[model samples]
Target: MERDIIEELGSLALATRLKNLSERLAKDVSQIYKESELDFEPRWFTLVYALKEGEELAVTELSSMLKQTHPAINQVANVLVANKLVNERKDEADQRKRLLRLSTKGEKLVSHMSDLWGQIKKANDELLDESGGILLESLDKVEEALDNKSMYERIRSFQA
Candidate 1:
């Protein structure tokens, strides 16, 4: 009976439902990008969006905000600078420190993307009901539990 319950929890029906939802969300986001005519990948958008709200952030600060490494942030910043979407300037207080800010073009692109996201949110609202909120809350709990469980902790307290 226990084996059967476990199998039911991992059934193909549940897998298909999760895959379908992911595919739908991806399609919606892709459509929004196509409409904006913005050639940025998702990671680029994340950085650009962060800069849209402010001006001039140090590379290390940006990396911490994005939860990414310095090298990764630098690589993306270099591409943006080369494309003229962002500008890097030397800090006045510290000549050795470089600060990053979005250029005029980048600012416009981020504004357009924000509008597109609003539209996506409206569409999603139409598709989801009150049950959706409950499901999301449950999923959040599961994710939190998983995040708190380290591999070492799991091995030391193995029950299964």
Candidate 2:
């Protein structure tokens, strides 16, 4: 079956390209993270980005939004609070519930980081264009497939 054989080869080629692209993306992210002055892990940037949309969020809400375990999110939130990047306050309606909000300093830092990221993205787009449309098209397909799958399902498929 020549058609079946061709499809198998195509799948293998796609898989190899995906792996290479993932490696490059990881390196790029590491480089970007190194540019930040904060002594925090790269994941902290996700939290910062999440808070960029609004001021206050309950700890549980943030945990859900970030798709992180409650304890893990709590630990990150605590570190942010200690660094004065985020403030914790008791909810007015329910004093027992704690709300987390970005501090003014945090907002400024996020804004600056956003600008830097935008520049990096523009540079990356230029480079991708120079490399031809193959990589960009492949990444777009991967993103669409990911959007159609659950996060865990996508991760499991990658692991396999």
Candidate 3:
């Protein structure tokens, strides 16, 4: 059997390991969506779902809502616009601000995927539950601790 670098590094490689896990999971979900004949990417779901639930939202508002950087949201928005799944319009009250909303195509897709989305959510929840919810609880704790003092600052503090 080959040695696992991530397992060997343990807590010292927490960030790297978490990133690896996240990327793998995202790939799995993306494959499922592709296999289902859905023209969607897993990374786009967060913004898409937010737009589906809300009437419309400004770029900054979406950035805040999704807890993503403005540039990040804009990058996804660009792709969504190209795919004809979302539309960008100038906010009436603030011409400088642009609002985003799902296009008709987006609405139809969401409606079609509703059942699949439910199944995906349930499956994910079951997996977490099977882990006794420790994965989520521990992640929450880690996020809270990092929010108090960033990882960069913590590391620098330990340096000689």
Candidate 3 wrongly placed segments (more than 4 Å): 92-95
**Candidate 2 residue lDDT tens string, 1-160:** 3466545778657667667766786677777667665344555766777788666898788888876888888888888999998988998999977798899988877776777768768877887888894877876777677668955796698899
| TM-score of each model, paired residue for residue | 0.60, 0.56, 0.91
Model 3 residue 78 CA deviation (Å) reads 0.7
Per-residue error (Å), model 2, residue 71: 2.0
Q: Clashing residue pairs, candidate 2?
A: none
**lDDT per residue, candidate 3, 69-111, as tens digits?**
9999999999999999999999788898978999999999989
lDDT of 2 at 67: 67
Runs in model 2 lying further than 4 Å from the true structure: 1-30, 36-40, 120-160
Q: What is the C-alpha lDDT of each candidate?
A: 0.77, 0.76, 0.90
Single out the weakest 10-residue window by summed lDDT for candidate 3: 50-59
| Ranking, lDDT, top scorer first | 3, 1, 2
- Stretches of model 1 off by over 4 angstroms after superposition: 1-28, 92-96, 123-131, 134-160
Tens digits of per-residue lDDT, candidate 1, 1-160, equal 3366445667546556677678777776776677778666655756887799866899988888886889999999999999898999988999988799999888877776787767767776766654465766676776577669954576689765
